[model samples]
Target: MAASPSLANDNKSNVQRTKTSLSHLPYEVKQCIVYWVDRFQKEPHRFGSDSLLDQIAGGINHPGKTESRNNHPLLAPPSAQLTNLLNMHRFFHTTSTTNNDNKPSIRPQCNSILALCLVDRMFYDICRPLIWQTLDLEQFHLSKLRSLRTGGLTRNAEYVRKMSWRISVHELEALWPDLREELGANDEARKGQDWDESSRSTEILAILEMCTKVTSLDLDLRPTELDKQTGEFTIDETETTSKFFYPISRLTQLTSIALTTPLLANNSFTEQFLVRLIRDMSELQSFKCYGTDSVTPDLEGFSWPLPCGSPLGLHLSELTSLKELYLQQSDCFDFTWSKIEWAGNLEKLTFDGCTRNPLRTLHAFCQKFSTSLRYLKLDYLEYEKDVYTTLLEPTRDGPLSEIKSGQYRLDLPELTTLSITTELPIDLLLNFRDCKNIKSIELAMNPSISAEQIRELPCFWPKLEKLKITINTKSDLARCQITALKMTYWGKGIELEIEDEDEQYNSARFGHAYEDDGYDSYDSYHDDDSD
Candidate 1:
């Protein structure tokens, strides 16, 4: 064969071609394409769309990277507005003050994935899943129901039920007519049912009945309206759920339920309600509710709450299947200790601000679980992140896990992790340091804690493989320094070894030590003349 073109010549030819075409494209259009691909992972529609890149016919020279601009600093657009607020912490903390910093900005990849769907059928197929996955109702809520519910079960609720959850009670009302129509309601029967005092509202019962069957449900019910006559409820807006939502006797498939706005209270309001709710909701894996005062009757001799030892009251103690419970600001009611029972199967629990409001039966609190409890968070209620200090100035570290007499001496055998997001007022190390199963722990503190408290943290957390500690110190660089001390597990049988394989002695290394094979000289530490 004749002499083939040189490799360099071939590369040069390709470069020349790239330079010519790239220069001809509008600069803005190219940048637009980058942004579109960056956020959504695909280009815009090739047929009809305004792009800066498409405008530039030609340029004098080859296209070159423009000066850096700190745009799209956040990489992922968080799902919740609350999460966006939280992301500001990382953004503000990580931002550099240096004038010449040239770090590239990042946009969430979800955007790029969305753009691809609009490009072409092939690209749409590839990007549709990513784009839609982000739209899943796992993190969203539907609060508007009046109008949408008007469309009836054949329309909105039927359609949305397949794609999303988190429905409001109001939506249920608007869908009442459709539901009534679907359930074969006659005008004469409707009036009689409405007049029935002992009966539950058909619409409210319907939404609960229909949505409870959904596999992925975390229903949050906020009381919108309370009946003035028979005490039935009618939310402001809601969707039409399935027709015959038999009172709580049949809803056994619910996965999660959040009862907000005290629609059910006064151990008497719905004796049948509780009995039927707990007994029938067998599939309810997680539960939360903000119950109100046990009862507030409208008329005299109404003496609500049909005796505490009654059969209806015993249903709560029977909830053995419930796994996770969140008591979020749920202390408006003076529920007694006997109201709740220990769910041996519980795995995770959160008490996010259950204000201590004279619990008439203050007996449900406990420090131990029948099985291993994996996660527990109770800090959002109070300002103190140091759950230890909150337990009355922890003077020592470890086992005081229970503090009934305003003191803790509790046992947590299965605790594999612990976190105290506040300064250790006493020895940060507590008997909990003996939590042999623990592998992760996070300790943070507010500015209110004293300096001495922060200094005692090193010894508090022991045997931890993963740890996060926040120390409040003087910001004055000349007066402050931080040391990351790494220690190995204490010797089990023999003496403790001072030498560890992972240890690197900063003090031993020479400031200017050099190696023969052109190794760089050490220069991390300053050689003080005084020393």
Candidate 2:
């Protein structure tokens, strides 16, 4: 206690001037700890890993799975609960690199927000809007439009709110070297093209007019040619429709588009620029489109005609604030769904590999969005196999038995996630046995679905809670994993998830099929499609 050396050097200079770092916290605690270290450095198994316990140990050989921590490999020292259960999963899932679609790509590793922006200037202004939100130019080049025009990244394009470009025609003739002499002086059978006054802006429309706050695009005009007999990039619809849809119809504050084209099924000038860019968006809420994987599950339905008095169903009923409509392998059954008076504010409808006659237009378009649908999916849907017992039997008659005795059973009442596939049966699950607020089911089941039709799905979804069930072989994925572990030990909290589609049908018979589930692989370009 020999204090007083000038009062202990002024209390060690007031404890080195109140030492605290992350720029002295509290800017909402340094933005919630830099938003969970930028989601633990971009989705570290959503903050806990070991590949989510090997995806809850259902990577097969079942008998209530969970045992292999790689057969006792952790020789000691790792504990901080084994380094937070290996959240950096062997340094971000085994050091990446697999691309040309064999999958495992993994690039975006922002080096923990560039080492928390070198720990200064308030973490480079909180990691500059998480590194300019998202501007994925899907392998785009022209030196990334000359580094978003003259190396400034167009003043951080208002922190781009999601984009995934891929427009083509050789990236618009390398951003208009007179765009192939203005498409051969505007006469390639001129239905539309008219950008004259010195080609009204080009470099991809000045980087999508400097991304004025994009709201989830994804564009991808799909013009890959290569295939000198199997070098790959096959589909090429002879490139024409790209005035980048006239600067993507001036964005109109897009709210989720998706597009990916193959000239919207035989291009009537890209189906009149996707019906005037979905009638100027009107704040579109999720549209998805997709189209060409060169469709096939016996390819017949592909109608688009329109233009007679074409209001395009009153411009898709003025969108009325649409909600999530996806139509992969596109041309969703030549619309006019009784002049589509909009899906009464639809909530997630999807119709993948759409071909035709789902009882002549999907049970009157799911009985006009059966009371605000909540996630319906219908995958690989090409009709006929006695069209779901001639549209749910009910003592068979014409015109779907007066909509199956009026209001045809699909009483959605705010459904809760159902995905289809086994080519619709189980008597069309009695048209969604009064959906009973279904909670996540995704079947794809085929081996003639029985174990008494999986014990009548908890007596028709009494609030079913998650069942996946993909199965296509390996002895019906071990007899549907012993009837989903006897419906989860009979207590029925459900939670089952099995997949094995015979290694996705031998990787879609070796053409290396990779549509990663959000639809399109109609059995990888169809060889008499079955599962």
Candidate 3:
């Protein structure tokens, strides 16, 4: 049945009226609506499989690999495959999701913004900048770079504010042919010249040059080509390996920088480069470095008690804006602390998996920054001597005696959060009695800490709001009983979380333990009325 002429005319008039109403909205209002709609469409969970909690708990060490879905011949059919690859990069990239059968499968990228752009030209202009604000080049292909070079997305480079590039040897190998082509090298020219790593460095530098407004940069230059049997890769020590540092040092506008590579650990040139880099960036606030091993900078020529006015010492002293310093698997504590009296404005400090140092050195370092330090995390740290006797014990003649007699306390007045993994958490807490404002504490406790010791926590910090206790135990029943007992004392106002060290083992054992008892779940034991 065909529609009547009057009905079709009325529908057309209604559609036009709605479009006119949308167009009449103010420019700022339209932009705000579009920005929020984009965020709603691409929520955090839709971005990747890993949760925010996993990142905070340090569960993920390295970036996850992107599963490949399509393959093409390397030499032949370059044009068609390049187009297909760009299309896949644009839309078909996968995010992890589960099917009804409880198996992992690929979920296509959300294209709501692309659909919204097609509604009108105003919507298209507003949504384009938001889409290009953050670029994660974890699954970068050579074709994507090619697109950027040919003015396909080159004009949008100014919109980028944050960028992360995780480059590996495999990515360099895949990029070689396209890079040579872009450089105007013919087949004969490619065969005549040797493959120089500097050419690969130049390609990365070129990409960075386009994004001048980037404020946060995450660069992981660690090689991914590990031996299958040994699970290790040889560190490359050539001039070309250090070329990437030149472009990075030029990014003085960056406020936050996270670098995960062994260059800082193995290369002497990296130490000098870092000093120069830190000297130039006056606005740099947060710096995090993760290395393959303990990052003890090679200070070979320097004499004992490095002079305060020395080049390295002067450069570090110039970091008046540095607030957060995190060194993972790095022994920068001894070298850095010994050189300077204190980091100028440092508030948050983390030393995760660092090598054992003298307890007195750590004690002196903390005391130096006690007034300004707000958050401290010492995970998996070890000491050369007993912590209680070396740090907590009070002798009549020693400075710690003031803490025992109530004349003074460990003066971390600004501290509100503390996380530590040690044998004696109780003794460590006693040392920080002056931190009256501390609201959150995370402790990795061993079996030596009895359930009775947990009850004493509230008395120490009456304003405590959150406590996360991770028990290192082989006995599941013991962990459960201890957790239940702690919850009883903690009550309902505070947020309390208890978990075992072996997550998988605890999950399997807790199922049977809960079934045997009357409780339906572990959380049920938290009820105040329960016996």
Candidate 4:
């Protein structure tokens, strides 16, 4: 270690400095250097793959990097600005030179791609934690693990090495498997002297404990095979029961949680898991639950989790601390459902599916917590008649299944933005006609909606500070109605009332070019989209 006096000495000579190295730098300086080298300077890390190296060097490091650019001491090894830190020495060369033989890793974590796999062990140790800052647990990735030779060990290890904690847990089961083989294979630890559920459980338990570090968790619960004999669905007990539970239970710091899948079609854990998950995440700030199937009422005899007798509705009532709630594709009348009863603090909401039942129930639900909503999103939405009310209408003393109002009452006094995909009627605009606090409104029309019908929506979004409309015809906005403070077209990005002269050099268009999702349309020109 260099002496403290030597580190601070401004007049130190080469002899004095020769004794110092990366460790001798101040703590802040060391952090900056490591942040740059690991995140930016390492060319492979920037592109999230090592292919960039071969591409730049024709399967090697660029000749000029080692001979000229890298050797420059003054500005050669540059990192990102304070707010942005990236060491771009490697990345710059990859782009400056041309070599396209190598492939880049997608969603490469800083630890595995840039640190461990691409760099030497020395680099791996320093940058491990940063790579795990954010994780994405896609369901398919884990499903593949269930079929691996090492009994999900190889898949788990390889994935863990790169992602660290961002991974899916419930995918550790095959779509179809014989009950005997599945149980027998999972019982190998029983063959040993210490063979017991405890040992087998411990193996997967460790995987979950490691996943506690994940800050962003995405869970997709899709359909699995049903037991042909009993007409009951089956999941890998070890994966969902052990591997999935532990991490979810302990990951209390998660800020974003997305619960999605089409499994509710054939499976019954949709509501059960959602409740258990919400209960476990007491500090959760963001929650999104999207279902791709109709929700069926829970049967009275067989509980979802037979061993642990708990229902979804009871668990949902426990989500008192939640701030953001999003629900989609839920059948309105499903006795056991995932609906937001009290979203007093919800800041953002995106409904991917539209249901008439929920719409009827929404008036009362919205009134219950109308004071705290900020943003609302509706996609693929279409109004439906209140089946709940229609049934109750026949009997006067029947259950209060329908909402008091025919249309959903949106009393969001603090709402700032509203995004909905629907055909707006001219008279329907009266609902938000006088919303003074609303600053932004995004509405998507179906391709089939006539231009005449499109114009029928009351043009009273004038209070909007930002208005975005997607039109199939160029003439839709020819004399666009909403006179907002800031009017932005869907073809372009959410343009601000202000201008960005330097927008030409911004990172607006800097991701996979082929992913032309509407979100990235205007992003094609993002300045950061270079090598």
Candidate 5:
């Protein structure tokens, strides 16, 4: 054999020569090929026609990724729009969408875009942006990011649509090694001082400038310091923290936002910061706010920016383009039903770990958007006294008392999925007697809920095709009986599961109740309360 160096050179020369003719292919044609390949490799079985060539090309890039015939009939049909949304959150994992179906199409797998990159130089250039579409600020390599932004490694900063970054006061010193001077006058002063505008806020402002195209942002800025000894998250009122509203307002393309910070509900400035930031995003579609544990804001106690007006409500109402809203791990005493104007257009609504609403608000909300609302998830909910009974009341020999109260028919014809976990009342299920379109229903509770109540769900939701429930019971006989009923439902084309879950943490993690487990674990903090 010739010298090893010459052998390697020859091999590289041969590989390069093979792709010399690829340039002859039209740039648009090359892009078109890569686009469909990217979709097939990552997308679900969307209801659209695909050419034979498309499938073959996609298979070349991703060998195993293919559609299956037996996807769960209950789950939503593979939506191209929803698949794109799912890809955006894969980087943040915390708020990722999940499919309970066993079929391969519903379950999105992480197919490496690297394989496409290896095909050729042009292929790499075309497919590179998608790989960087979602950036996790913490896990991302800081050195490569600058190169990707400005340097000639192929700047693809515009591709970053969804990004999440976490900032905790406990780790402030570590994050800003050079901010010691601003932190304090001396070593003792530095250690004693809390995080302020001069420290962490400046750094965040700089970071946001780099990713201007970010549409979905999960920003968790916990100004509160957690005492290691006592294991409590506390915020010092005296210290002044910088407002992100000004910097965040610059991200005009922002549509979906998950704002997880303790300051919003606890501090007035932070709440205003959120309000101003939201007011600017006229195109915002989905909004989720994570507040401090148990510090649910009461709608009754809120001081409106306008006299006798719900400022937050009014501010939210201005978001005419808004569609989805999720409020979790916070109370909504001030977030009344009447305040929301998106009721006509809102498609999805979720309320988790929030205080119960008055009967009138709940009923009016359900009725207002009954036609438009496709998804409703209520977990770790608290209901006011007699609220359930009032909603569950059947149409009697009374006049139309409330809107659409002809015979107390609370119809949600458009509702496809319903989740009721934790303090969610079984009577709420009964209220859905007119919800003929509901295909999926999730009900999980402690052993306190009776077997008869769970059994009666099928009767109310005649159209339900999927059911997930968890009940805690010590009796083996009880478990068997429940499992038997669940199987009976399953046999009737309703994909069903009856989890005899004993773990309190699992229940708490899934948004049942937050038990004081000394320190807050990741599950307890974020509370992935999806059903």
Candidate 6:
């Protein structure tokens, strides 16, 4: 897209007008150049994905003192001063021209558009909006966003299309007084437990209003509680939560929204607001509610109390425009697949650490949306019962009455990609018997999967292009069987990947040590578990 002059500045004289031969390139080409230049920048390893912060219970020092904990050096917020100065004079746009320093230590992690600004005025004018397209804002510096909006930074705000906020409950609380003062909140409201929701909502609204063009938002809202005597930080039952519904509802341009932490909502207003917020986002296409283990994972069986008299009530099926849905480690009550009839347009669905959903619910899901679904990922999700055992020794199928009932047949004609990991039922895999369109399949090895079952996978997925299986270290000699299977059938060019549980679990979840032979130690028992 061509850069908008109103996005940053319209004055050509303010930018360095160097007449270089490269300046003749098109604006889109310059954006391409900026992309390649920034391709090597180190991205955040874990952007609020892990639940380490959530595990910290009880009160600790305020977030201001520990602000560096959440600060991502690569995603530093935009400098209003630098942007304003660049807009005022050409000299400010001209940066160091040294291009030979390829060393990582000397590399600049700032937006690549800044480098283009140094090239010439034409390039600067063409590439300025590229810098503001995506922003990583921390709670500590959120107060400055309002200043940037009013004081010569409004143009830059409109350029923002995506935003990721790394918020700490402590830091948000610490900065509350300042934000309250900025919004003209009273002293009583600032000190009291029941803070003025209007001022708080207005503060967020003010900030979000400035970034009128934002479409995607990733929020890491981890709440913390303070210990009065011990001076420790922990998560307590404190009711201090911010209301974001009204503020977030104003993002009419939003298409993609992701909540990486469950503590984003603190009180009734925030919870109810979230439902309304989702309902109002008419343009939303991709929605993800990611959870760290601290919140949803802990409330496995507990039902999330729904707001009274609220029609929406956290059910997202009403979002007819939604195309992709991703839920990770979130409680089943937060949003149930069976509770609402999903839009027919839904294409990609992912469930991670969200294992509480019944097998029947999943079966029904595939039956309901099988025509439109294409990509499906079920990772770290466990089945309610051991379908493998039930299939082998069947008195009653419990809820999975397959052969006796003979009514429920697995049928998804549109699915192309499927991934399942960690304690998935063998009966669930039977559903793939009818999914002929599956091109890629990922399965995690457990005691439930027999050698015969593994051999039959390729038969079921005739169009399989890629196969990835994770073998648990405890499963004896399963790796050898997988290798044999690969050599037997996969020599025809199907991509095959077999990862040990140590490698998969260590990097992905809690660290667990192991041997290269897929055991805890060299002397561990080696009885064959594969049937």
**What shift in Å separates residue 463 of candidate 2 from its native position after superposition?**
18
Evaluate model 5: give its lDDT: 0.52
**What's the TM for model 2?**
0.31
Model with the higher lDDT, candidate 1 or 4: 4
* lDDT string, candidate 4, 1-531, tens digits: 775545335765545324333334444444444543443433342354443333333322221233554554322434333222333332333333222224434332333334332344444444444443322222223333233324534333322311212122222222223323444555453233232323333443454455434444554444344456763445566433334553554666665566555332354335544554556666565565655333353342233532212244344445555655566665422322324344335555556553532443444444455677666666655553353225643454212222232244356777677766654332333455445577676655444344454333324544444545565332233333433323323222333322222332211111112121122111111211121
Model 3 bad stretches (over 4 Å): 1-24, 31-129, 144-152, 169-202, 221-240, 262-270, 291-314, 335-343, 356-359, 384-409, 473-479, 482-486, 499-531
RMSD of 2: 19.5
| Candidate 6 lDDT tens digits, 1-531 | 996556336544555555434566655445434433333232221112221122222222221233442353212332453233223222112234222222222233454447667788877765556556666554334345445556644667766676765344333443344454553545564444223333333444566667776777766443343345753333333322234434565677677777644333542123233454565677777776654222223332345642222233234666777777766664542333445555536777777775554554456665668778777777775545565236544454444556224344567888888877766445566666688988878788777677667766777778877777788665664557766877755555666677887864232111111111111221111111110
Name the TM-score of candidate 1.
0.41
Tens-digit lDDT track for model 3 on 321-344? 776666666544454454475447
User: Model 2, 125-186: lDDT tens per residue?
Assistant: 76776677766653444545555666656667776676665444433333345555655644
TM-score, each model?
Answer: 0.41, 0.31, 0.58, 0.47, 0.61, 0.56
Superposed by TM-score, candidate 6 places the C-alpha of residue 420 at a distance from the truth, in angstroms, of 1.1
Candidate 4: worst 10 consecutive residues by lDDT? 507-516
* Candidate achieving higher TM-score, 2 or 4: 4
Best-to-worst order by lDDT is 2, 3, 5, 6, 4, 1
After superposition of all CA atoms, the RMSD between model 3 and the true structure is 16.8
For all candidates, what are the clash counts? 34, 0, 0, 12, 7, 13
Model 4: residues with Cα > 4 Å off, grouped in runs: 1-25, 29-127, 137-209, 222-256, 262-265, 268-270, 276-279, 292-314, 332-344, 356-360, 384-411, 426-430, 447-466, 472-531
Output the better candidate (2/6) by TM-score.
6
How many clashing residue pairs, candidate 5?
A: 7
Window of ten residues with lowest summed lDDT in model 6? 522-531
User: Residue 269's C-alpha lDDT in candidate 5?
Assistant: 21
lDDT for 43 in candidate 4 is 33
Candidate 5 regions with alpha-carbon error over 4 angstroms: 1-109, 138-154, 169-204, 222-243, 262-271, 292-308, 329-336, 339-344, 383-409, 452-456, 472-477, 498-531
